[model samples]
Target: MSEHDFHVHGPHDHELEHAAQHEPKGFAGQLAVITAILATVGAFFSYMGGATQANAALLKNEAAIRKTEASNQWNYYQSKGNKQNMAELAAELVSSEEQRTKYRDKVARYDKEKADIKLKAEALEAASAQADEESAHQMHLHHRWAQATTALQVAIALAAIALLTRRRWMEWGTLAMGGVGVVLGGMAWLQL
Candidate 1:
């Protein structure tokens, strides 16, 4: 036969090549791809929820610090008695009282801010929890995916062994497994 004829009629010709490429994958590879995708989504929602909770805690701490500073200033003025220094002490008292009033107002504003933060944090936390629940379902999917992936890998290896030993069936199985692996890996990456 001519070289071109040999090429066209070869055992590994176009029809066989197309058939090998289009073969169905085993169960294991499909499961692994699904799980990896779910994990990526879960991690994202968890991070956002944690950030909101942290911000609320910080606002609460700031408000407490301001209240403490105002109280300390008032105490310092009171500690200095009202004898011959009564006028100066009186002026000091007025100044201290004004400072206390300003701080009190600030404290109120801070309290409102803190409350708002808490509300936001709670909402975020709820959202995070929902994400976590969804992830749990995904975990099961991951297990199935992993199992399928492992099985396909094993099948591919077996197919390689079969081909090396000149077994036709093994070659076909290997080709099938390879396709499965590629699809699963692609799916896993897309999940991210």
Candidate 2:
């Protein structure tokens, strides 16, 4: 070969250019970008799942505390009942009219107090039940978010495999998994 022809045609450019042309057409690169986006979405779903679980736990604790308070109030009601019974028995045994009147007055006060305590305890127990219901609802929400996160993670894995294998079927698999993730996330968002 002539020196002029050698200078015009370099060895490095043609071989590399030929190989570059044979590579897949931007499929892996696009898949990589999509996988990254899906991973970000997965993180969001994971965060929501964890947060909802924590909220549910907090609500459950609140319910327990309210229940304990109700129990304490009921015990107080029992003590008040015992006091009223004792006063009625003493009034029966007393000879002085004034002493009997005083004991009767005490019975009335104790009865009124017990009625208020019973009402308050019942209200607190109802509130505890409501909190338990709310906690269960939050737990359901958490489960939905967890399912969405799992689907998203699977989609991300499928996308990575699609990028590595460059198989069109794998791309479809990734799309299907991503669709499932999106549907689950929508259900969570709608609280359904």
Candidate 3:
């Protein structure tokens, strides 16, 4: 082969040497990366579950409010005392009663809907919790995951700091811990 071609393929070539000379991230670096990923996942699911619960609660409250308003309207119509007004008011009361009944029915429907939503939210929450637990367990398996997966993501930045400082051990440890935090955060965000 030509000298130029030989140089290109040689192990001592600049590109090859540069790539080979790169510092090893080692076990710690791998652990940190894995932990961070897991934590992020956990956070996402938790947020989703919480948001579902909140929406269900809001719907339930709205149903109650509507029912209350309907009752108030019915009572107001019944309270007027003039005979002519009373007669008209009585009719209005009946109409209001119908509306109240409708509202009550709506409330009942909402109640059922809310119950279903609540159940779904609860199930999601349980899943989120289980994910968190698993992430935490992973962190325990490797300290790096636990430290990097904080709920606040402060740990992730901290992991970067450790990396920058050439503190491979700390970096990995932080990353391992962060997996659960990430998962929980992700869950919350999804719910929102």
Candidate 4:
């Protein structure tokens, strides 16, 4: 891309503004300046909002996968518990001493297996919670960005009216709207 793309009016943006400072205050100049600044800020907010929303979606998906894994582990742990219970019952019912000893051994094995499964399930749940928290934070960022975008859009619309009517109050109203957008954009950056 050309260097001109970086500035609203190529390399002459500063020069143009300096020249405009010496010229008479008029609707045309004011409209040009305000519209340019608003467009630049609006573009930045749009890009940031898109990136944040994408990150949120990815985190949400990760959380869902972790939750599913946690659920599967819990189910496996329950199955192990059932096996342990059945083994205990078998030990009580069997008449032969050798068979009773085997059932008691099986019960011990299931108990050990259940302990491991429970740990795995708990770890997965923790991971899911972390992912969910991050996803929620990203969603909050997106909300601020959305509000900023709306304000910027309104400012742009007001700027158009100010240009058409050459009304100073309309220009001030447009500036106020842009201020709101900037504040919201800053809030999104702070993420607090």
Note the clash tally of each candidate: 6, 0, 44, 0
Model 2, C-alpha of 174: deviation from truth (Å): 0.6
* Tens digits of lDDT, candidate 3, 45-132: 4454444545545544554554455455434333322333434444455657776565555545544554554555455445545554
Model 3 spans > 4 angstroms off: 1-22, 25-36, 39-43, 46-50, 53-57, 60-64, 70-152, 179-192
- Clash-forming residue pairs, model 2: none
Best candidate (score: TM-score): 2
Clashes of 2: 0
lDDT of each: 0.49, 0.91, 0.50, 0.92
Candidate 1 wrongly placed segments (more than 4 Å): 1-114, 123-127, 130-148
Write one digit per residue (lDDT tens) for candidate 1, span 1-192.
666664346666876676556544532343334334434533443443344345445544544554455455434334332221444444446657776566555555545554555555455555555555545545444543454455455554655475445455665665566556545544544432
lDDT string for model 4 (1-192, tens) is 787676446667887787568544876777789989998999999999999999999999999999999999999999999999999999999999999999999999999999999999999999999999999999999989989988999999999998766688889999999999999999999995
C-alpha RMSD values across all candidates: 13.5, 3.5, 13.9, 9.9
Better of 2 and 3 by lDDT: 2
Models 1 onward score TM values of 0.32, 0.88, 0.36, 0.84
After TM-score superposition, the amount by which residue 110's alpha carbon in candidate 1 deviates from its true location, in angstroms, is 11
- Angstrom error at residue 182, model 4: 0.4
TM-score for predicted model 2 compared with the true structure: 0.88
Candidate 2 local distance difference test against the native: 0.91
Q: Pick the candidate with the highest lDDT.
A: 4
